[model samples]
Target chain A: MNKIEVKGLYKAYSDKGRRINGYDECRLPEGSTVLHDINLSIKRRSFTCFVGPSGCGKSTLLRIMAGFEHPTKGWVFIDGMPVNGPSPRHIFVFQEDGLLPWMTTRENVALGVRDIKDSDERRRRIIEYIELVGLKGFEDHYPHELSGGMRRRAEVARALITNPDILFMDEPFGALDFLTRLQMREEMINVHMMFDTTILFITHDIDEAIQLGDQIVILSERPTNLRADIPLAFPHPRDFTKGGLAALRRDIYFQMGIHTAL
Target chain B: MGEDGGERKNGFMKGALSKCRQADRILPALTVVVIIALWEWVVRIFSISPGVLPPPSRVAAALWGLAKSGVLFDYTVASLFRVTWGYFLAVAAAVPIGMFLGLWPLGRAVFNPIIQFLRPISPLAWIPLAILWLGIGDKPAVFLIFLAVFFPMLVCVMGSVAGIKVTYFRIAQNFGLTGYRLYTKVVLPAALPEIVVGLRITLGTAWLVIVAAEMIAVKSGLGYLIVDARNSLRMDRVIGGMVVIGIIGLALDRIIRRLETLPSVRWKRMQR
Candidate 1:
């Protein structure tokens, strides 16, 4: 069975004025049709990258796949069970350091595994992930105290500590600088190798889509449908500066509606 | 971690000291000092009636006199207890109900109209009804205070939940949290900041209501003390009571301010 399956999804958000009666709807108040007629399947343990233009519904599709959002008209299945809400066994990391502002780096990393009942094992795993992200001696620091790169690293530690079967990341490195972005990419590749979790990542950067994806899915404009599903052959720690990777970057540029700006 | 993070938790105090030395920060405080100085001079220069417009010094003297008698302390404690009981009761009832109303559309729709219709009615207006229901003493005063505090704070909490960043909610849901976990994990923490703000404002309003109610409802609190002094024409005690109320209100507000200190501010020099 595919680790994740999206079958003929249709979702629309109706944004209307606030009610005098003070009811809050889960859907957006401003009508936005984010996803329309999306059908796809992600094989187990594959590194899949979702690339598209702004507001093309890549993020929305990722949310639906993880069951954070419900489709207005379709069904999603993960591991043969219908996707109803968040699957605890699946982990998601987003662009912002979703680290609780109050929690120390350690507490945030330890969040998922803390309830495991075995204190020592949980602590050891938390420390291991923290150290894996190359954040040593900074476990006590809060999100605001860390630099942007460091905060993202802490997020990485938090996500990976859970040992999830599927990892969903939305624009994870889109906020970092060039040098830091490269470093984060390398760390992600290493973490993927270590855990072998099926990762579905969304990114606007074509180079990022090229460097990390085993198969890159390019989405069309919104109410979005598929444009292309191209596979990247380059293995992890793929050097973007290398000529082979650079060529793939050129192809993704055309796909994103930006014609080889580089 | 910087040494200052550990040693200088007194950011406001340190700021004041630094400003005093730099002269820029202290400038604002200095202006207030100057205004007080000028006001003191003017009142004394004009020889205003000790009753009608007592000088700052006379108010200070009256404060000292009350401190010595310890009767001022007694009145102060009564006021504090009344406000505290009412404020806590309002919060205990309002927070969870507000959370429920904010989370579910049905509850909000059902309760919201009722809340809105009643919101316009002042707590003072409810005094007579409160007296009738709870019978003319402490209960009426407490009920009035509760009415004044509960609705505004419940609205603030609803606003806080409404304003929660979409990403925060999404992240929590992605972890399979629903039911009680959803409330304890995502909604509560995200709404904390705005809820604290509501609690602070409610406490201030509660203080006012308690004092006002005590003057008529109950007999021994600061509000009654003020009325008794006024009727007896002991203006010094009245001024003392007013000052005591102001100081207590200021102290309560400062406590809330500390509690509501921003997440970033409390985090490793995130504010400074």
Candidate 2:
């Protein structure tokens, strides 16, 4: 079953001088198009990775799907209903600095389950989610006090505690150190395995897309259109140094205008 | 053998650290003492008349006299009462209006020019009008202090709210928080650190205005004490009043600063 469907999606910015709020990274000139006729279908519980070039509007696309911004013209349907604005059932984990710096880890995680009427049940779930993200002993620490990776974990816990049907992550580990990014990727996979929620992740790193994606959607440079949609059925601990994964990696590099032979 | 050496080194470092902290406390006191001594010596060397520039001893004596007569306490309480009322009133009004303006661009556009225009005009300019409208006593002084505090605090609160990271709003929206819930749960807490800073700054402005306000509009505050003392040719009492004002200003600043140390808002300091 398809969890989300994007039909004839197109986005453009009419304001030339002023930068758009929330999409500060992608500054377009007057009437310049971004995503051009983007169409995608994300299956339920499948981890889809969006890989694109810099300023290719991948984040814009993700934000549009999450209803943070409206497309110039198109429709995004989640569970057969059109998305009007951001909904509680769909959570977005921003690339960085998403955790409220003023809030403790416990308080931030509790944000998702704030509607739970039962106090004991809410406390239990908040603690459970905190432990699930391996932030047991540091519940009282603010976002600034936690390490970068720990802050990311807290954000993920906050998102997951709501049990959203679709989790939109925009380059969640882009700011982490190499070792922390690798560790987070493993933890991310563990999270996917443990939860039944569908995940839509955006990244510019090809290796990250190859490693974490169940289906990889490649996007082209400005006025971005869907370049390729490749579904990887490879099992866990799949080696990318050799075999089909390596060849596929080379193919992606070539398609992205990067020569691996160099 | 190495363990004992490490312990000795640790003890040395601890002792050095304590000594450094002690220096931090003592240096300010030492400077105050030196300045007072210099002031006294200059007064004695110049043989300055008491009416022109009283020595520290005479100023201290005058302060002791006020303290004994209990007028100092009364003056201090009056000034504090006006400041407290004016500052709280400004805070109560400015925070809500600031939030509204900060959140609503159209409203901000409508009102920002008026605020900016009024902001540059000194609060002293309002003295005649305050006196005319409210008459004498604490009312006019409080009104002037309110005028002094309200504009800057409004601007500060608005800036603080506007400065909140867009990501936090996105998170709030994603969680379906809207309207009052959004303000109470997300906006208030997120803008608190900056608001507390704003409160501290505006309180300083309020304290400054109160003295000037009291000099013209009221009869019981420290400002009145200084002016009334000058009328009687008591330079010592005037200086003493100034000293008391300085001390109370420092105390108010210290109290507001403690709010910044709260765990919820402490991230501002950490970020710095």
Candidate 3:
């Protein structure tokens, strides 16, 4: 069964009137379409990557599915129920620093599960997740005190500790330096393997898409629609240097209108 | 082997931290001693009139006299009481209202302009109105101090609340937090560092206004002590009063600084 389904989703922003020739003009708000007719379903316990150029509305589509945004047309369903608003069942990791600065690592990870009445159980799970994210000794450190990669790990732990059925990340590793990015990617795969939670990750990096995704959804430029949905049946820890992945990479670049050297 | 090395590292870190803390205290005390010595030298070298600029020794004598008479303690208590009540009251009243204004656009639109207009008109200007409205006593003085703190606290807290990154709210929502939980858990903590900064600045202004307010509106505070000493031509007492005010202001500011450094809010000053 599909974990999430998006059907004919559309989103648009209305630009407020701007001054022309130094005169205050009352122009009608004109809609600039961001996503057009976005349709796809993410399979259960799958890692799906939405790859596209910058400003291609992949994040918008992710937000709409996460229920942080509303689609101008069409619908999203989580387990056959239409998504009306944000639910704890789905956690969305923002691209920016989402960890509350005032909260320590333990507090940030524990915040989502605060509703749990059992204090001992809550503390135990918070510790477990902190250890899972490799933030064992830094539980008392605030987000600002943590390095970029550690902050991202804390954010991911915060999301996962909730044990949501699906997690949506919007270019989560985009801000990290190269070595840290590689380390975090390894940690992320370990986490996915452990939790087995379905994930929908959005990124512009084609290499990242191939490295992490079991299924890659390619998106077109502005007024974005799905250009392709390619599924990989390869096992975990696949070698990127293999002939098959190289061919796949060339195909994706071709789909994105880039001619690869291969 | 690694465990032993880690233990040795921890011991070294503790020793270094203690040494640094000692330096922090000693440096400030040394600066004070140096300043007093310079003042005593300058006064003697210039042969300045005692009425114009009394030596530090004379101010110390005057301070000792006040302490022996118990008048210094009384005046300190009076000023401290006014400042404490005024500061707490403004915080209590303004924080909730600021949150409301920050969250709700209509409320901000309606009241912001009025607050902006009132904020710039020095709270000293309210002395006449505070006296007329509340009558002579600690009440009028307290009112002026409250007025002095209220607007700045309100403006800063409102800005802090409004300035919260939208992404945090989305994260809060994603966690199923709404209404009060959303605010107390996410919004409040996120905005707290900025709010503490606002509180810290307004505290200095409150201390400043209390002295001025006490001089005119009340008859028994540090401000009154200074004014009374001036009228009696006791320059030593006047300088002593000034010294007491400076010390109290510095102490209050240090207290706020300590609060800002608490583990909960210290993220505002990330070393990086």
lDDT of each: 0.79, 0.90, 0.87
Residue clash pairs of candidate 2:
none
lDDT by residue (B1-272, candidate 2, tens digit) is 27699799999999999999999989989999999999999999999998899999999999999999999999999999999999899899999999888887789889999999999899899888888899999888888878888999899888888777788899999887889999998898878988998899999999999998888888898999999998999999999999999999999998999998898789867855
Off by over 4 Å in 2: A16-24, B1-20
Candidate 2 is graded, for docking, as medium
Off by over 4 Å in 3: A15-31, A177-180, A190-196, B1-31
What would the per-residue lDDT of candidate 1 be over residues B1-272, giving only the tens digit for each residue? 47687567678688888867788757867996897688689888897777786666777787787678887778788778777777788898989988878877778888899999998888988887888899966778888888989999889887777666666666676555578877886788767866877888888999988888888888778898889989988777787778788778888898888876666335423523
TM-scores for the candidates? 0.86, 0.95, 0.89
- Candidate 3 docking: what grade? acceptable
Model 2 CA lDDT for position B185: 81
Models, CA RMSD each: 4.4, 3.1, 4.6
Which segments of model 1 are wrong by more than 4 Å? A15-33, A236-248, A258-262, B1-17, B20-44, B55-69, B262-272
In candidate 3, what are the lDDT values of residues B1-272, reduced to their tens digit? 27699799999999999999999999999999999999999999999999999999999999999999999999999999999999999999999899888877679889999999999999999888888999999898888878888999999888888877677778788877788887788777777888899899999999999999888988899999999999999999999999999999999999888878776677667734
Best-to-worst order by lDDT is 2, 3, 1
Clashing pairs in 1: A15-A29, A15-A30, A15-A31
lDDT of 3 by residue, A14-123 (tens): 74522221111223235778889989988999999999887738877888898977889999999999998898878888786778887889988987687799999999
- In terms of lDDT, the best-performing candidate is 2
First chain TM-score for all predictions: 0.90, 0.96, 0.92
